[model samples]
Target chain A: MNAAFALIARDVRLAWRHPNEIATILAFFVIAASLFPFGIGPEPQILARVAIGIVWVTALLACLMSLDRLFQAEVEDGSLDLLVTAPAPLELLALAKVVAQWITTALPLIVISPIVATMLHLPADGYATLLLTLVLGTPGLSLFGGIGAALSVNARRGGALLALIVLPLTVPILIFAVAAVDAAIAGLSPRPHLFLLAGLSVFALTIAPFAMAASLRQAAE
Target chain B: MNWHRFASPSNFKRLSARIFPWAAGGAALCLGCGLYQALLVSPPDYQQGQSVRIMYIHVPAAWMAMFVYANLALAGAATLVWRHPLAEVAGRAMAPIGAAFTFLCLATGSLWGKPMWGTWWEWDARLTSVLILFFVYLAYMALNNAFDDATRGARASAVLALVGAVNLPIIKFSVDWWNTLHQPASVMRLDGPAIHPSMLWPLLAMGVGYTLLFVVLALVRIQAELIERRLGALVQARLSAEPAA
Candidate 1:
C-alpha cells in the first residue's frame, strides 16, 4: 500500500512539474471540440442535439493523444525496469501510474468541458449529465489506454497501433457513457446507464492493471 | 506418449501434411450439403418471408466469425502460458480468416437488411457492435502486419487478439442489454432453440456447414502459415550461407 502510494506520488509530482503536458492535452481537446461547431455550422438546435456525442468523442480523442505517454516514457528511461523489480506488485504500481495519467489528461478535460459545452450551445440542463458521464467514463479510458500503451511499449509506430487496439475495446464504455448523458438531456433517468458506466470502470480498473503489468513484463524482456 | 516430439519442425511438417487433405475435403463436403439444405430444403420465414432466407448465410457466418476470434484468443493465451510454438502459428493463421468471416457476415447482413428493413444499415445495438467487431478484426490484422520483426509482431498481435476476445461477449449480448431492432436469439437460448422443427433443421444444417468451413479454412491456412515460415527460414538460411558482398 505504501509503495503504490509512493509511486503514485512520484508520478503526480512528475506530471505536476511538466505542466506543458497538461496544456497540450487541453489544447487538443479545445481544438477538436471547436471544429465540430464549424463543421456543422452555428445551428444551436443541431449543436444541442449532438452536444453529448461531440464532448464524449472529443474526450476519447484527447485521451488517445496523451496515451502514448502512459508507459512510453518510463519504458524508455529505464524507470519501468526499476519499478517492476521493486517489492510492490507490478499491477498496483501500474494502476498508480494510470491514476497519475488520468489526473493529467482526463481531469483537465472534465474541468474545461462546461466552457466547451457552452461554445457548442448545449442546453443548461445537459451540464449535470455531461459532467457526470466524463467523470465516470474518462478513468475507464485511462485504464484501457494504459493497457494499450504497455502492450505497444516495444513496438515501432506504436501510437497508431495503440489507437487500433484501444478504440474498439473502449466502445462499450463510450456507448453507455454517452447514453447516460443523452438520457438525462431527454429528461429520462440516467441512473441505469450511469450504474453501467460505473460498473464498467470498476471492471476495467480491476482487470486492466494485471494486463498492463503482463505487457510491461513482456516489453521489459 | 511423446508430448514434446511434436515440437520438432520436421514432425509438425509431416503431421500437418497428413491432416490437411482430410480437413479440406470435409470442409468442402459440409459446406456443400449445408448450403443445399439451407437454401433449398428449408421453409421460408413466417414474418420476413423469403428475405429470411439470408439468415442461412448471415447468422452462421456471423457465428463463425466470432468463433474464429475466440479460437485466436485461446491460442494467444496458450502461447503466453505454455510457450507452445504452434499457438503463435494458429493465431496468425486465424486473423485474416476471421477478418474474412467478419466481412462476410457484415456483407450478407447488409444484403438481408436492405430487403427486410428497407435500408442497408441501421444504428441498432447489434449492428453497431458487429461493425465494431469487424473493426476489431481489422485492427488485429493491421497490428499483425505493422511490425518489421515478424516474431515481435506475432507476439504483440497475440496480446491484441487477447484484448479483442474480451469484446466477444459484449457483442453477443449487446442486443439484450438494450432495446434493439434486431431480435433476440431464437436458436441459442438457454432452454432450447425457440425455433420450430420445421424451420430449425435448415438453420442447423447451415450452422454445421459454416462450422466445418471455418475449421477447414483455419487448418489449411495454419498449414500454409507453417510452410510460409519454413520457406522464409530457408531463404534466410541460404542467404546467410553466402557472405555479404
Candidate 2:
C-alpha cells in the first residue's frame, strides 16, 4: 500500500517540479475551447446552447493529448518493467497512476472549465451541474484512458490508436455529461445524468485499475 | 485443460479441415432457405414497401455485427484464460470482416431510412448507438494495428474488444431504451416474432444464411491466420539459428 502511495507521491513530486506537463494540457484545453467561438461565431445565445458540448469535447481532447505519455515515459525509462515485476499489486500501482493522471490533466480542466463556461455565457444555475459532472466524470476518463495508454505503449501509431480505442467506450460518460449540463441549462434538474455519471465513475474506478494494470503487465512481458 | 489434443497443430489442422466443409455446407443450406423465404415469400412491410425488403439484410447484418463483437469478446477471454494462441488469431482475423458487416448494416439502414423516413441520416437513438458501434469497430481495428510488436498489438486489441463489447447491447436495445425513429425488434422478441408468418419465415431464412456466411468467412480467415503464424514462427527460428552479423 505504501509502495503504491509512494509511487503516486513520487509521480506527483516529479510532475510538480516539471509542472510544464500539466501546463501544456491546460494550454491545449484553453486554446481548443477558444477556437470554438471563432469557428461557430461568438453569439452568446449560440455559445450558451453549445457551451456544455464544447467544454466536454475540449476536456475529452485534452485528456487524449496527455494519454500517450501516461505509460510511455515509464516504459521508456524501464520503470514500468520493474513495476510489473514488483511484489505489490499491479492494480494498486495502476490506481495510483490514474489518480496522478487525473490530478495532473483533468483536475486543471475542471477548475478552468468555469472560465471557459463563462466565455460561452452559461448561466449561473448551470454551473453546479457542469462542475458536478466534470468532477464525477473525468476520473473515469483517466482510468479508462489509462488502459488505452498502457496498451498502446509500444504501438507504431500509439497516440491516435489510443484515442480510437478509448473514445468509443467513453461515449457513455460524454452522453451523461452533456445531458447533465443540458438538463441544468433547461432547469429540468440534472440528477439522473449526474447519478449515472457517478455510477459509471464508481464502476470504472473499481474495474479499470485492475484491467489496465493486467494489460500493462502483459505488454511488458 | 486438454492441451495435448489441440496443442499439436497438425491434428488441429486436420480436424478443422474436415469440419470446415461440413460447417460450410450446413450454413449454406440454412442461409439459402432463409433468404428464399425472406426475400421472395415474406410480404413487404405495409408502409415501408419494397424498402422493407432491406429489413432482411439490415436486421440480420446488425445482429451479426453485435454477434461478431460477442465472438471477439469470447475469443479475447479465451486467450486470457486458456492462453489459446488460436483465440487471438481468431479474434484478429474476424475484426475486418465483422467491421465490413457493420458498415454494411449502416449503409443498408441509411438506404432503407432515406426512402422511408425521407432522410439520409438520423440522430435517432438506435441510429446514434449503431454509429457508435461502428466507431467501436473502427477502434478495435486501429488498436490492433497500432503496435509495432505483433503480440502487443494482439493483446491491446483484445482488451479494446472487451471494452467495446458494452456497445453491443446498447445498439441492440437503443430503440427500446429510448424513443427513436428506428423501430423495435420485431424478429427476436421474447413472445415469438411480431412479424407475420409470411414475413417471419423468410427473415428467419435470411438470418440463417447470414450466420452461415459469417461462419464460413470466419473459418477461412482463422485458417489463413493460423498458417501465417506458423510460417512466422518458422522464419524467426531460422533467423535466430544463423550466426550474428
Candidate 3:
C-alpha cells in the first residue's frame, strides 16, 4: 500500500510539474465542445438536447489524447524496468498509475465540464447529473486507457493504435453515463443508470489492473 | 492419445493438412445445399418479399462474427497462459477472417435494412453492439501487427483480445438496456425454435457451412503462417552462417 501511494504521489508530482499537458487537455475539452454549435447551427434547443453527449464524447477523446504519454516518459527514462522489478506487486502499481492518471487527466475534465455544458446550453436540470456521471464514469476511461497505453508502449506507432484499442472498451461507460444524465433531464430517476455506472467502474477497477500489469511486463521485456 | 503432441508446430501442420481437405469438402457441400435451399426452395416472407432472404446470409455471418471472436479469445488465452506457439500463429491468422465476417454481417444487414426498415442504418442496440464488435476486431488486428517483433505483437494482441472478450458482453448488455429497436432473438430462445421449419432449415445449413468454411480457411492460414516462420528462421540461419564464413 505504501509503495502504491508512493508511485501515485510521484506520478501526480510529475504531472504537476508539467502544467501544460493538463492545460492542453482542458483547452481541448472546451474548444472541442464549443465546435458542435457551429457545426450543427447555433440553435439553443439542439445544443441543449445534445450537450451531455458532446461533453461525454469530447471528454473521452481528451482522455485518449492524454493516454499516449502515460508510459512513454517512464519507458524512455528506464524507470519502467525498475517498477516492473520492484518488490511491490505490479498490479497494485498499475492501479496506482491509473489512479494518478485519472487524477491528472479526467479530474480536470470533470471540473471544467460544467463550463462546456453551459456553453452548449445544456438544460438546467442536467448539470448535477452530468457532473455526477463524470465522477462515476471517468475512472473507467482511465482504467481502460491504461491497458491500451501499456499494450502499445512498445509499438513503433502507438497513438492511433492506442485510441483504436481503448475506444470500443469504453462504449459501456459512455452509454451509462449519458443515460444517467439523459434520465435526469427527462425527469426520470437516474438511480438505475448511476448504479450501473458505478458498477462498471468497480468492474473496470478489478479487471484493468491485471491486464495493465501483464501488458506492462510484456512491453518491459 | 497425447493431445500435447499436436501442439508442436510440425505435428500441428500435418494434422491441419489432413483435416483441411475434409473441412473444405464439407464446406462446399453444406454451402451449396444451403444456398440452393435458401434461394430456390425457401418461400419469401409475406411482408419482406425477397429481401427476407438476406437474413439467410446476415444471420449466419453474424453468428460467425461472434463465434470467431470467441475462438480468437480462446486462442489468446492459449498464447498467454501456456505460451503455445501454435496458438500464437492461429490467433494471428484468425483476426482478419473474423474481421471479414463482421464486415459481411454489417454490410448485408444494411442492405436488408434499406428496403425493409426504410433506413440504411439505425442506432439500435443490436446493430450498435455488433458495430462495436467489428471495431474491436479491427483493433485486435491493428495491435497484432503494430510491433516489429512478432512475439511481442502476438502477446500484446493476445492481451487485447482477452480484454475485448470480457468487455463485449458488458457492452452488449449496456446497449440493450440503453435502447433497442432490433427484433428479439427468434432462433436461440430458451423456448423451442420460433421461426418455421421452412426458413429454419436453410439458416441452419448456412450456419453449419460458415463454421466449416472458417475451419478450412483457418487451417490453411495457420499452415501458411508456420511455413513463413520456418522460412524466416532459415534465412536468419543462412545470414549468420555467411558472417562466419
The model with the greatest lDDT is 3
State how far residue A193 of model 3 sits from its true place (Å).
0.4
Per residue, candidate 1 scores C-alpha lDDT tens digits across B1-245 of 43332235676667867776776677677767767777777777667777777877787777888788888899888877886668878888888888887888888878877766678875555556678888888777777677666655667677777766775676455434653422454222212347777666767777776776776777777777777776777777789889999
TM-score of chain B of 2: 0.83
Q: Write the per-residue lDDT of candidate 3 for residues B1-245, one digit (tens) a residue.
A: 43332234667867887888889999999999999999989999776789888988998999999999999999999999998888998999999999999999999878987886778986666677889999999999999999988889999999999999999999999888766413454212212347879989999999999999999989888888877877787777678779675
Two-way TM-score contest, 1 vs 3, winner: 3
Off by over 4 Å in 3: B1-8, B181-193, B243-245
lDDT for A133 (candidate 2): 97
Q: Can you list the residue pairs that collide in candidate 1? A: none
**Best of the candidates, DockQ:** 3
Give the TM-score of candidate 1 (chain A).
Answer: 0.97
Model 2 TM-score is 0.91
- Pick out the ten consecutive residues of candidate 1 chain A with the lowest summed lDDT: A173-182
Model 3 misses residue A36 by how many Å? Answer: 0.6
Task: State the lDDT of candidate 2 residue by residue for B114-232, as single tens digits.
Answer: 88677887555655677778888888778777766666667777877776675455334533344322245432221233767787776777777777778788888878877776777
Which number leads on TM-score?
3
Please give the DockQ score of every candidate, comma-separated.
Answer: 0.51, 0.57, 0.87
What lDDT score goes with residue B45 in model 2?
70
Q: Weakest 10 consecutive residues, lDDT, candidate 3 chain A? A: A67-76
